[model samples]
Target: MMVQTGLPPMMAKVLVYLFTSDTEGLTAAELIQRLRVSPASISKAVGYLERLGLIRREREGRRRERYIVLDDIWYRTWSVSARSIQLGAGTAQDGVSVPAPPGSTSPISA
Candidate 1:
């Protein structure tokens, strides 16, 4: 499913696991064991999610870094992206449809 969405399957799995977990965070080693992915794969997926601002990294005292799903990660992610989408919608409404990329189309009609 994630492959169809142009995301790595492990990355999607990592996200689902994080969001569904009772704990707020997980270490890479734990994620590797739980997800049955390579250490490198865990690192890669964590990096991707961090870059997306869906997760945050916290360093323990002289220990491994932990990746946490922010309390309002989805809200935060969509809040930022929504602004961009709004700008695109405005541009489209202003007869500058070409300024917005095809992928930037809003789900709601302007």
Candidate 2:
């Protein structure tokens, strides 16, 4: 269902895990351990989720960053997107459909 959000596979995977965890949050290290993925991949996926307003980052004490998915995540995401639209912002996907990749003839996946 969430793949329709146009997220990369790993990012989508990360988001699903966070959403279904039934906890307030999880740290990057925890995500890496649970997902068995490279730190860079987890970082990239988590960063993307944050940028999309689908996840929240909380800092605890000195060195921990916890990623949380709210129960009303879709509402929060819509609110953020609505605010951006009202502020005259363009979505990153705005022009994605108009171009074919330079070196490849394959159609871009949705």
Candidate 3:
């Protein structure tokens, strides 16, 4: 479902796992182990989610970063998606339709 909404598969997996997990947060190692993905994949997904404001990366001690889902994550994600849809719809409405040259049988040609 998240992928269908235009989120990449890896990011969706990381996000869903983070929100659904029993723990408060998960480190990159933990996410990699649980999701069975490469470090690079987790890094990319984490970066994407962070940029979207769905998740935050907190410094744990001096050497590790834990990724936690932000409060009201569902609402935030929905708002983001809604904004994107609205932007797309606006762009579609602003487009100029080209008419068929002549003698075209297409229903929308005019």
Model 1 reaches what TM-score against the true structure? 0.65
RMSD of every candidate to native, in Å, equals 7.7, 8.3, 3.0
Per-residue lDDT tens digits of candidate 2, residues 26-49?
Answer: 899999999999999999998888
Maximum-lDDT candidate: 3
- Model 1 Cα lDDT, one tens digit per residue, 2-72: 45544568878998888888877888888999988799999889999888788889997697988888888
Best by TM-score: 3
10 residues in a row with least lDDT, candidate 3:
92-101
Which runs of model 1 end up more than 4 angstroms from their true locations?
Answer: 1-7, 80-110
Q: What are the lDDT scores of the predictions, listed in order?
A: 0.80, 0.81, 0.91
Error (Å) of candidate 3 at residue 26 is 0.2
* Model 2 Cα shift for residue 17 (angstroms): 0.8
How many clashes in candidate 2? Answer: 0
Candidate 2 worst ten-residue window by lDDT: 88-97
